[model samples]
Target: MEGLHHDTIVDGEEDDSPAKKQDSPVEEELVGDVRIEDFSEKQINHSLAPEERVNLYEQMVRIRRFEERSLRSYQQGHIGGFLHLYIGQEAVAVGAVSVMGEDDHVITAYRDHGHALAVGMDMDECMAELYGKKTGCSKGKGGSMHFFAPDKNFWGGHGIVGGQTPLGLGIAYALKFNKKAGSCLCFMGDGATNQGPFYESLNLASLWNLPVVYVIENNGYSMGTAEARHSAGEPLARRGDMFDIDWSVSHGHDMYEVRHTINDALERAHNESRPSVLEIVTYRYRGHSVADPDQTYRSKEEIEEYKKSKDPINLYKEKLIAEGHLTEGSALEIDRLAKEEAEASAEFAQASPLPEPTELMDDIYWETDNPASKTSQGTMFFETP
Candidate 1:
């Protein structure tokens, strides 16, 4: 706690862009718009019921542990294929997923383990999927980048740069057309934000008033490219205004800010049937995809500074300890449990068998009204059930 106060603000934002339009104090006062309950400075949050607070903390811890274990396993050559870690971006997952229930949907790029865990997907199942085991979430057909639990409302882990954006919009459109109250959270990195799907998805989402939250995890780099060198406008939050959608930009490292942003976005969606884009300015502590070194893009000092100063888990722990909800022993116990869970997940994946080559013909498709829409896989030409 001695050094906690100095890290209060991770991002020192100064913008003279049109997005920084000043709000009149008198007008805001007349409408009670500045009420603390009504407006929050950031999306990461902590003002909630004890149960909810504990639950959010658990999710973030689970995400951190999951990433740590996965990265370790990848280094040891236990988990094969592309493994993108959402290490420092756990707050985005914990805060956003906390706002939704079973019926709502989620979609994101390859960095998906945290999103799955946040949405109540079993860690064991997720790990099994990563290991390409037959008992995996996608039945081992898809590994780290393509695990889809439709029954769990997880649309998928898309690999294409900005592929999931359109699919997410379609899902939200389907829900709306079907008279369901569910919305979709479409997540992508800052690198993917400039892709065609990003603009196309936003246009259709806002035009149709689809209930979709297009979240840009701005981690300052798209692979080895820095944001300043890669993006024309580093701020993604204000980009939504051009499409006539409401948005919030917040520090992705702060849970309080994330929670506040999610609540606000969902409120606008539920009340007015609108779309939103919540830009979370976050950073990933690891390399882009377990293949490249982040040193090519960022300095070691900056990384270490973020690691020491703005760790989401430590920040939340400090707050909880200050408020007396958490003790040092209890916090350590939580960490122990997270590590144990990861261990169990690894064991489960180890014991599970991989899918057979012939079975690739199966588990690829489901039935539809039109028989022609059925998909087949492998050289056997057997229709995937």
Candidate 2:
């Protein structure tokens, strides 16, 4: 189950010339000529209740504000380590997670603030984790890259590229074994799509008919390398064809379209025990990490263009206002509240304490008497023979 399938071969590795230049037919169909202008005219589906629309907008705003504050904190030296901001990819996480139930699982890559917030992890704990306080979701041991809330079924924000793919399969298998009415959402970056584990996981998921959806948040670049420079096949979603898994590519800027597509994928996973691949075309406003100078690879004009024309928050706000679900004043109020909340969380993190020395060994092992329970000390307890 862990090994690679024959069909999992890299597209252009054999010839080493260039991958036969071609557009993915599936991507072309799924992502039609829907431009940024279409969002203004796109009617809000009646199925999406008025309250739900507000909630989606609020969640996206909250994530944006939090990431903005996190950047400030990093610059001010309050938060350390590599900081990967989820600034521009808000729609993908919020839209997709909105369709999921409490029982469903979610896991993603290092740039995970949006995923954690979208899945309902507390703002305080997430901010605290970034600040390296003991109050973090991983008790502060895991930094910006590792936010885990098993209680909320958010497995983690893994640091390794494509590492979460296999773990996602294991979760899906467990859910099916227990006959749970839920599925797993395994999210990875465009960079991760090139790794072997991604292909291997897809092979197993399709072979076993596991209840999982592998989402590639194609933000155009893996670190500093753009997708075109790194990925062999342009559309990562088509990789699923090798395993006979249903796959589609979609614009992540539009919340409604993203929500509906993910909802359908989750439905198929939960009821039919099928898996799918979703390549979400999104963007990140900042560099790969806070440390990297994003200007070297791409131009300032490119970033400004995306922020001005295709920002998820701005588009959704306009949509809500156009549909009469929200007013300009009310939308501004939401943004104000989100900013206040994010600031409060940063203050809370600054006031929180660091982990104690004794806590270093905590969560390292499980007691033999009760293997299910976590233990700080790795001590053995057995009766004499």
Candidate 3:
């Protein structure tokens, strides 16, 4: 909370000069500070029934608990490669997904377990993916960062930064071309915003007026570099203004605020066939990946402060309890159930068989996996002659 600056660094139109040329309007709000009291009962998660709100709370708990389990697994050397834990940003994924319609889809960066769970992905499959077991969602091909459930309209946990941005644009294009009433929620971290592909995706999204909401989960530090140090422009969502795309920012810790802002963007996408940039200010408790030591860049105090004051799970849980939708006992029960589910998932991952070595080339190509569905001819891949 100390280093979080929601105000845009650049204000109004930039001074017209050869060296000082600036793009887009710069007016921005102090975001990531929206409190639970900011919204009235009628305005906050109003559409959701009491039971549904409790479910949202449960979902957040599940994500947090799952991440905690995964972190422990990573520490125990059960997980390999990169394990990007989504410990602090549960509300953003869960709240956004809660407001989505059936046709709506989701795609996000490598820190995707939360999104996966939010979209109804089972914990066993997710944990198995991390464990590189055959039962993984990707059949053990994609560790930690490559979970995919096309049936659920969840694309993937892409390892490359900003690589999923253009793919999200394609999803939007298809939805529009097919005359489907849906939008794609393309999520990325603050670090991904600096990538070239993201800007390209934004350009086309604005140009074609695709129904895609580019959700930037700005969690202060991009990897180890503080956001202020890594990015030049303040309030990264304002970049949307250059392309004439509607953009807004909000606190990611508050589920109601997350739902409100994301629903607004989704409405723009669905109704006007337009794209929007919704930067949900969030924070991560872990490093960019499990391998990186987070202490080098960010102080322990800052992380602790966020955990104590702005934890999404705790805030939502408290809100639900205050509203009489959830009692302390119910909250504890929900958390206990989440912990049990997480532990069971870990056990499932451990007991699950590792993928056989012979399956290396399997699922690599569509034609290879599904001969009946293969319409294209010719050698898709080359074998040693």
Candidate 4:
């Protein structure tokens, strides 16, 4: 927070005095970052009541704690095989989903524990999934990489990189075909943005004017590979332009900014009936998965920079306290509560049962002679066949 500088490059073509951002009711530009300024507590008018603010604060903390615990469990070997922690991306889910009605849909990549919690999945259930429990959200059939909540209409924690993009658009297609009012927020990573499906999906989504929010959580790295190393001149935000979709970016480290960014994206997708892009530029403190040694690509100084200065949780607390919306003692209490809740969930998850051998066939889509139901997420509706 202290060492960062913000010297804006003037757009020489536009006679730009540091290229100003477009005006909006829900977004603004904060200090030290060129991304969209969030309508933080200070910027918000008498819009949200005190109770609503309290609930929002609690949900963000819960997501933060749930992810922290997931990381710890991953380290301890309780959670196995390619666990991706949503350490820095909590606000993108919490704030986005908070503004969505019950019917809105959310789908994202493997870094999805935060989304599951934000969308009302039980902490016990989430941790149980991490522990591969039979009573888990995905019934222990799909481990950390795949979780489906039909009740929440939270489509997935898809394993294949960039694979979920089209599925989300398909969901939007279904919503439109039925002439129903709904939206799908398809979340992907910077790495997955490189895949073919990501672009193809965007083209179709934009052409059909599908109600989908294609969000790129550009954490600046694909696994240990830096963005500069993996990505071309292709700014992930501009990916939407190929398909003529609306594009925007925000400070991914701040929930306030993330919330505002998604709010705007969803608004466009809702009112305009077209796709949109929001590139949330943030950083992660842990390794790509639980297995890597986390020593090679990035330096200690980089992690320290993000954690000490740009940590999302700290940013939220500082802005709230400074605005007099959250007291110092209240912030401390919230942290205490987050720890207690996380511990309780961990214990409960530990006590949860693992999948029984007999339970294997329970959720299989193709139990009998239906060859069409091969994939877990496949549909068997009538087609041109």
Candidate 4, residues 110-147, lDDT tens digits: the string is: 88887888888888888888898977888887878888
TM-score of each: 0.85, 0.86, 0.90, 0.86
RMSD of each: 6.3, 7.5, 5.3, 5.7
Error of 4 at 360 (Å): 1.8
C-alpha lDDT of all candidate models, in order: 0.75, 0.81, 0.84, 0.73
Counting only residues 3 or more apart in sequence or on different chains, how many pairs clash (N, Cα, C under 3 Å) in candidate 3?
0
Relative to the unseen true structure, what is the Cα RMSD of model 4? 5.7
Question: Which window of 10 residues has the lowest lDDT sum in candidate 2?
Answer: 1-10
Residue 7 in model 1: shift from native, Å? 13
Clashing residue pairs in candidate 2 (N, C-alpha, C atoms within 3 angstroms): none
Clashes of 1: 14
Off by over 4 Å in 4: 1-21, 24-38, 41-46, 366-385
Error of 1 at 97 (Å): 0.8
Per residue, candidate 1 scores C-alpha lDDT tens digits across 255-359 of: 766776676666666666688887777778888898787666677877777777667777777767766777889888888899899889988988999888777
lDDT of 1: 0.75
Off by over 4 Å in 2: 1-45, 368-385
lDDT of 3 by residue, 110-158 (tens): 9999999999999999999899999999889988899899999999988
lDDT value, residue 256 of candidate 4 = 61
Predicted structure 3: lDDT? 0.84
